[model samples]
Target: MTLFFLPIPVNSPLPDLTLADILERTIELSQTAAVILKSYYRGSPAQLEVIDKAEGPVTVADKAVDRHLLDGIQAMCGDSCGYLTEETYQAGDFQLPQDWVWIIDPLDGTRDFIDKTGEYAIHIALTYQHRPVLAVVAIPESDRLYAAIAGGGTWNITADGVRTPIRVTGGKELTKLVVVASRNHRSEGLVKLLAQLPCQQQLKIGSIGCKIAAILEDRADLYVSLSGTSAPKDWDLAAPELMLIEAGGKFTRQDGSLLKYNQGDVNQWGCLIASSGEWHQQILDACLD
Candidate 1:
């Protein structure tokens, strides 16, 4: 029943908040999510577990960190905007405010987290008027984070705190492409689709945002998802969508349609592809065939 947003300021001078500031703060929140997740990981195994209404396992780390990130954003951005999150927002009860909104997934790869595979990540994306303008994807176990500020470009922070710019590699052929697919969400349709391709390699990773991060780093060439009746949530791809586009990559639905956010339905069903821009459409067509 609680609506989320930044409070409208009447008298106080507006802070000179920029996309960079938002990105920096989002990274900080991601680190916070990391700490929370790590705490659960190191705690008594029996105590850090949970079960959601959908019968999905919701570990202590997941809910705790989800609250932490949501609270963190609320504290920073206040009541002027709205919030949409994987763990908190109910589709029927909430509608996005007209101003800025946040789309978040506190623990994206929950299954991987439960298994302690270190492939999970926390996703934080900022949307203005329903389109992502700033985003952050943090992989705590690996000590890596990827961020983008609308036009600010994509950046990577190494485990040691070193920062580097990231971009998709240009002009790679389909035969030599290295695709990164979802570790747990892969569909039989996608497997059959890829089987027809002459791709050189594929890496199955957890989290859509995390997979996009791989593409941003050029570690893997592409990230593809074949959706079923249930589409991906807005929180699921909002950040990755902008981050990948700003990183000079292509992100679109399986049929090559552009993605739009704040559609009420969070799930993004259908074929989805993220590539370094050069061969994005080629991969889409191949998958469709």
Candidate 2:
């Protein structure tokens, strides 16, 4: 793994901040997080200690990793940007300056991480004027990095500095679609609804970000999260949404609504879907019905 230190000069000129630069900084933080996470992998009883917050299960690794990324973003952007994160902010803390905002999930697949499944990742995104312009999703265990810059394209940054463009598949029929569902975050109603879909296969993965990564990489054709009270938050979906969008995919609520951020309510209460746009409307219509 490359050194987890950021090298971007804060004194660089504005408008010259490339997507590559943003992704580089994101990867830097994620790589740092990877090191922290590896220390707790298959942890001892002491390391496995869990704290039950009202939101859900949070581990020592989650808090530690979040702190790492939070400090990283602070250093990378300084005080010029506003921040929103699952681990750091509350509903009323959405106030910000006008330049840029960062939506982050320092660790996106907490359950998978706790279970030692090697499926979790660090999610980071830079939003410009309420729209995501750059995103990076780093899978620590796999040492793989996936990133995108709006209109700049998506790539898998390898350990040796190689970058490869990623594209989603265009499957023609709903019956041929492969759906990636939530591993620890699904409901009975969603299960029944998925069963009724024309899906040819269903994959259970951890994290909304990971499921979206599945679609962005063509590993699966779609990902659907249908829930009311337990809906996803902007931090959970924002980074992956940007990556999937830049990779030529689409994402929205079940009612075909846009995913907006910093709404004071972190829990985005609605049906969420990410697909290659081919069978997206089909799934969306089914969920609506």
Candidate 3:
């Protein structure tokens, strides 16, 4: 692991790190987090600690790893970046430290974590002008990391640091598409939408990161989110959206508009779809029409 993140005392002047520098450090922080999580699992008590938040279940690993990722990024940004994190974010505190913001979800699927499903992930994204400029989605259990920068293609990186360029599958046949759906959050509307897309295979999975990773790896062809009240926040979508789009996929609202982040409310409600881009309009028409 790289040692780019040096411990900085609170209230001291932060070191200046550009987006390029921050991206490298973010990857390192994620790698460190993967190790930290492994330790937590091994030292797991017979009944691990869990808490119910408004969004979903959170564990000790969620809070602790969130703090570490937030701190590591803050140490490099000085006062130039805002932060929206799942554990520490307060509703009104979405202040603009700067136009550039770091959206993070240190642990994305707490239920999957509790179930030992290895479907959880760590999400980190840098957004400017409401779109991601750099994104990293780290799946610790799989020992894989997916990252994308603006205008740069996405890559699938092994734990040993070998990287291979990745792209979405070209499965455009209406009768043969595979769709990955949320394991924990499902609604009637989602069922209807799935039913509408007749002949598409369905896969229920935890963590949006893992679901999108599946699309990029060609394990699945699409994923959809129809939020009802408990909508997904910016942290849920930012990192993986970049990964998918950079991999030649499409992520958008049901109407095919691009997803914009840090728009004050943070909740990404309503119908959102991610497809392989080969037949996105075809799927959109099937689900919407």
Candidate 4:
């Protein structure tokens, strides 16, 4: 087996590492997470040990992967950097020192994982100055990894380590657009909005990462989330948001505001849209009451 490791900048602090360096390290970390997730997933069903949380169901695999990612990030970046993750994050966790913060979802689609669907993923993103600067999304089931840096473009990496550049399809007519939505958390508001869209096709998928992957791979043109009382948290959006933007697509609130990270409130309390930059404005207009 080839052992993958992140090379810490010699005699330099984490803050000194360039965005490219951070992107490289994050990819390595995500690959490690892929191994952990695949191991748990291939085990007997009994090993899942599902537990209910106020937000939803969590499994032993979720917590274990969360701890591993948190510890590994802290070890590499130092404890001074802020950390926010789906498994262990608290409401106020984002208030910590934030020169740099890691926003992560150890297992992005726990529901899908528990249901034996292979659409779940691991997300890790580095946010600086309230914006994601680097990100990695690992879909272990497909043995594929997606990564991006703020201005460096996006790429897909296969299990064999081959990298291919990826981009969103250029603007298509609304009637020809293909939309994807969350499989497990569909909302009535989203359904109503989708009805208004001129999209010709729709798909329901399990993970935020997978839905975003569809857009990146040109399999889908847009992903929409219409939130109600509870909304997606920082961990859910950070990594995928960066990847979409880097792939020449756009992700934003329904009102067209950019997502800001490391805020005390982790809940993204509003409708969100991801689209190939071409139809973003039109989609937002269609959603208007």
lDDT of 1 by residue, 193-287 (tens): 77876684988887777788788877788877776645567877888888888778889887777887776666676777888899877777787
Stretches of candidate 3 above 4 Å error? 1-18, 92-97
lDDT of 4 by residue, 1-289 (tens): 1122334222222667655666677788888888988888999888999998778899999988899888877877886578888877754644656667888999999999988889999999888767887789999999989987766678899988888878888867788998987788877877888888877598888999999998888888888888886888889999999999988999999889999987788888888999988989988988785
Candidate 4 lDDT trough over 10 residues, lowest sum? 1-10
The deviation in Å at residue 78 for candidate 4 is 0.5
Give candidate 3's whole-model lDDT: 0.81
* Structure candidate 2, residue pairs in collision: none
TM for candidate 1 is: 0.88
lDDT of 3 by residue, 100-208 (tens): 8889999998899888888999999988867888889999888999877766678787887887878777945767888998888888877887888855688888999
C-alpha local distance difference test of each model: 0.75, 0.76, 0.81, 0.83
Cα displacement (angstroms), candidate 1, residue 257, comes to 2.9
Candidate closest to the true structure, highest TM-score: 4
Residue-by-residue lDDT tens digits, candidate 2, 164-232: 888777945678788898778778878877887778498888877778877776788888777754777
lDDT-better candidate, 2 vs 3 = 3
Error of 1 at 115 (Å): 0.9
Model 3: colliding residue pairs = none
Count of residue pairs whose backbone atoms collide, per candidate: 21, 0, 0, 0
lDDT of 4: 0.83
Range of the 10 consecutive residues with the lowest summed lDDT in candidate 2: 4-13
